[model samples]
Target: MDEYPFTKLVIERNLTREEFAILMERLEKLNEQYEAQKEEGLIHFSSLLIHFAGMLTEKLEPDSTINALQREGFYPSLMNEFIRIIKQNNKG
Candidate 1:
């Protein structure tokens, strides 16, 4: 599938919705800790959080996606825009 490592893990592990949500929550917590501590790895954690958030969007419905992101402590505005773009592209 010419998959990158991240995509390969996502596709191959086949995590359930609940499992994925747990993973998201854990990542979010770590990201927050990095930010609060002003750790050098904050950048990497933020990037991973963003990447997982994108994957989460594809795995969830609009409302569910919003709820999931909110639960993970992300602001929803950008995600809403992303959802709109994804829907628009899918329509074409």
Candidate 2:
């Protein structure tokens, strides 16, 4: 099961519903900030995601993280969308 690094980390963390909600809220805010300033905001958002993924990776094994993320119904779609957007932006 292919998964983005950040998505795998999130799943490995096994965040509670509330935790997931909070994370989503933070991501939303980051996205809004990115929209406000495309260059700097994207840098900040990417940094945040990398940091979060690193934190989670430190807490669990890679195989476990992949398994957990695969169980999450929404993660694949979200991660795929993120990958698509990143690729699209990079192409320009």
Candidate number achieving the greatest TM-score relative to the actual structure: 2
Q: What lDDT is obtained when candidate 1 is compared to the true structure? A: 0.49
Candidate 2 residue-wise lDDT at 78: 35
Which stretches in model 2 have alpha-carbon errors above 4 Å? Answer: 4-7, 39-92
Q: Which predicted model would earn the best lDDT?
A: 2
Candidate 2 lDDT, tens digit per residue, 1-92? 24455465666677666666765675456445545655553333455345435544244543344344435543454344345445666799
How many residue pairs clash per model?
0, 0
10 residues in a row with least lDDT, candidate 1? 41-50
Please list the residue runs of candidate 1 whose C-alpha ends up more than 4 Å from where it truly belongs after superposition: 1-4, 39-92
Alpha-carbon RMSD, each predicted model: 11.5, 7.4
TM-score of each: 0.36, 0.38
